[model samples]
Target chain A: MALNLFEDKGCPLDRQRFTWKELVQPPISKLDDDAFTRVRVILMNGMEMEAIRFSHGCARMNRKWQLPLAQLRIVEQHQATMINGLLGADHSILETTIAYEQVAIEVTAAVAQNEPDEYLAQVYRFGMLEDFDHLYRYSAMLDRLEGKDANNILQCYTDIVPGRPTIVEHRAPQDNLREHYDRLRAAPITKLHALTIMSSEQQTQNFYLNVAPLYADPVVRQLYTEIASIEEQHVTQYESIIDPKETWLEKWLLHEANEVYNYYSCVQQETNPRIKAIWERCLDYELGHLQVAMNMFKQYERRDPAEILPGDLPEPIKFESQREFVRRILNQEVDLRALGTQFVNKSQEGVESQQYRQHLNASGSPTDMVAAGYEWFAGTELARDGEITREKYTRGHKITH
Target chain B: MDKTTVLGKNRSGIDISPIDIKEMMALAKVTPASSSGDEQAIAQMRQEYIAGADVLGSVPLPSTLKGMASTAMEKLMGKSPEGFIDKLGCRLAFERTGVRLYDALITKCSAAPMGAHIPLDRLHEFRNEEFQHFKLVENVIRSIGADPTAQTPSADVDGVISLGLIQVLTDPRTSVAHCLEAMLTAELADNDGWRMLIMLAEKMGMEDMARDFQQALREEDEHLVSIRQWFKEMVIKDTVGT
Candidate 1:
């Protein structure tokens, strides 16, 4: 059964009220080898199945319905390779640290060059910050492995960024509004660039969720859990961007295609044999992801769910409409501490709320307070505040609460 | 082998022009299209022109130049092999290879489980293009000396085309990306060939053949460009999305 986050009769707090803290927890124990293996298999298998299924679906669709199957296949193959490559990286802390650093640099450069829409830019920024945390977590894992200081391992890697041209070169300001609009629309469905932030976040979520459960050490497992939850937040942000009305299949397919395309493109340009091998492996993995998605679709085929749920659907998120997107640049600043404080406060409040108490009591209940909270907050205060603050933010300003 | 005397004197009286005879030598490398054109007359004229040229036999050229010179000499020496049979054979073989390759991929992709490999939709599209390519080649072959219906199957043709595709698909550097790069190369090569055929037809006053090849060439070029662009976009998308 699907996990629902909205309905609970026993919560003392109003049906709609909750905090972020109630939904998350820090690592309490280490992950054993069995747990790790299970999660890894599940995640990797799911991802690969999705990739293959999507590609096959596309081909079949083209053959039966006369779509551009060849072009779509090319895109699908590309995305598969990228996802596989990332997965193929050494699971060691040092390797993940380096990989994350490289991804951060690449994302930063892309943002600098294109100045993507506010949500996209925010996702990139968030992703970069998350990578730092990931670096730390992995370093901690490394410490556990080597019986040394995690901080030192982290410092060794993080220190390298300051000395390099970490940002992308600037291009001329684009006057082509239509082109930009098309880019934003097409970006999500295309290869690496997503139309919305959630798409990319899903990959992170899957990565952490899978890897977290696979660690043999408790500390490593805890760290993975923590990081995975953070990634889940990013996924939430992305999900909030999408229309809730979309069917699970549609959403899954789009995300799957996006991932496959990314890997496909990366492998194409990657000259390093190690990287290339990873890409090839990723292609197979993504194919699996597509297959999983297709199977899900097949399972759901008998049932008629709307393409998007009414509550889940929203107006397409746009950077132009997001005042925060504009504010970061105009203000030329972001208050990281302020944002952190807000998140922490909100989380603490949620944890203390009566609704959370009930949620804990009815842990296995079908009702989902978390989902409810997401809808309520996302639809009401959060949307309004995000829009309002977006106006004040400039292109390069630091984000704040 | 005096470079200055052979090339003619420069204003500075220096041997500014090198004694490279490759370019001059290549001028002789023309294959006759028909035995009916006064072969002896043309050869005599070519010889006379070579003798009259001050640089004749004055300087030896590079290996590449010598190869061209040999080709030129052969063309000058032989009568125009009457008929376009050889050209037709080359063209037919090339197009047939494209058709076969696409067909093979379609079969291969189809055999794989849905989502286990490339989508069937794309394979179908490729098959369509392959059919078109095959038709174009068939028409070319019929227009020349051979009857498309009567032409005997040659194992050599199959080997050459399949080998080329295998080379492309197996290359680690080339195969890393999606098959887009490989597809692009094939399309571009076919497009060039089509253009040449069109030109040849026009020169021969076979307006129908020229028109057909011309149209096919244009379409092929567009397909090539579009696929290439699509491949490029795919790369960018993959890079960014990850």
Candidate 2:
């Protein structure tokens, strides 16, 4: 039987079933590689105050604080796999491998060029350097894990030249960056995501913690553990950026709702089933996450912020702007307030009609108000297009105006 | 039926008259005959009368006032007393407004048929409750040396009440739910008004009234419990049906 990625089953190849105890031992021939040492040092050398400040600020703005532990683990696992695959691939897969890289580079360049703040440029530089370090660590891990030569993996990393028009110099570049960040932040954290990453880390962490047990061969388990710790550190870094005041439940719920909205929006607009399935599954995961969060919130006797706070409630998600709404109807985007005035005027006329009055008297439903407004607006549009005569207008005036 | 059997016959050396036995039976029957009806019919009538009677009986008395006052006092001690006072003012404002709205509606529909007047009657009952509520809260505030009316100006009072009335008339369930939410909010803000009312009454030396309000709080809790249980059951039924 073939393994299905969508379902729960063990790995396709059960090559070596290593216990937690055996995986953690250190290797004997530990060569201190220079580049790896440099990256590690950079990660460790940050000022305590700077770290604290960054952690505090990030936590406050950290939107994913409420995400379930299970979901975070899965995302981390997926990210690891993606990183590994990108680094281990040949020249043929280079184009696809560098897509995310290109995005990061472009964002960094744009920030550097357009941002007036010197400190912001420095921050971007630091972030870009960290991204490169991640790329290196991933490439190294991929080489060691597959028993492939380091030279081969290094070649794979270097073959794709950094794409140009790299720096965003435009005034509105920050807007684009903000939008990108918003979209990235919207992914739902799920139990599966959390479990996968944690399992992988557990495997890796076990390998590193028991350094003395496994001696001779390349301490592949130790290396895995070291990499896993880096991942955990990254997780902690992200978690720290999220405010501690907000319970994990609050953060997860917001993320889940956003994910569901995004998925539905995409599902409605996109034609591809595969793309739709991805979003649909995401929507399922988000809903599950929401249920979990709700359970936790109830246990604590705390209401969902979304339920209590005015702005926390979900707004109706819309794709089209005012311009789009007008363009679809009037061949151009008119001033929305002006359009509203026209609508209100037509509705006023409709209010005087017998049908409108009767509807109001019978049932004072908001739906009736909306329908009356729409009919009045439609009639106005028809009159503007010369589709109806004055006589017809007089006739309609009795029923709908 | 023999009258002698109905009442126990007195034994005497002399022959007792049959008239005496009849008279004794008549007196015995009169003792049990305060109100006359079939047992089931009487039981049904009693249930009907007691249904609304509990509403009055459950009201917190003066003794319960001290516990309620203590709660208010505790709230006053901990945070901005003004916030609590303002909320009480808002409640009073809404109650007064509800009364006026119900009165106006009743006046407008006086000529309508009895069938049409059912909703009006409900509104009237609710308005009457609101009036009682307004006075209750006002008295509570007054006991604490604050005037609820002064806190809520007369000009804004009508507008606030009208808004609540419109909401209630549009969707009674939603309006009731809103009131529940407000009650919950107030209780939470003051560390449970029901509990506090009991505490205040006890503190103010109104032990009996305190006990009454405690009973009222228990009744309120029962009502809430039933509403929640019913809601849950309905939701389950709906899901299953669907």
- Using TM-score as the measure, the top candidate is 1
Tens-digit lDDT string for candidate 1 (B1-242): 00101232222111221231222113212311111221233234345556665521211222322343333223322332223333444556666666665555445434434522344575466557657766776765543333454333232443344565655543322322345556667777677767776765655556776776676676676667765775566565556642
lDDT of 2: 0.33
Model 1: runs farther than 4 Å from truth? Answer: A1-94, A97-115, A147-192, A195-200, A243-264, A273-334, A337-401, B1-242
lDDT of 1 by residue, A89-127 (tens): 213443343344334333332442354455445444544
Instruction: Give chain B TM-scores in order.
Output: 0.50, 0.37
Cα RMSD, model 2: 37.9
The Cα error of candidate 2 at residue A65, in Å, is 18
Fnat for candidate 2 (0 to 1)? 0.00
Q: Against the true structure, what is each candidate's TM-score? A: 0.29, 0.22
For every model in order, the fraction of real contacts preserved is: 0.00, 0.00
Against the true structure, what is every candidate's RMSD? Answer: 30.2, 37.9
Worst 10 residues of 1 chain A by lDDT: A161-170
| lDDT, residue B113, candidate 1 | 44
Off by over 4 Å in 2: A1-128, A137-229, A252-278, A291-304, A307-401, B1-242
Docking class of 2: incorrect
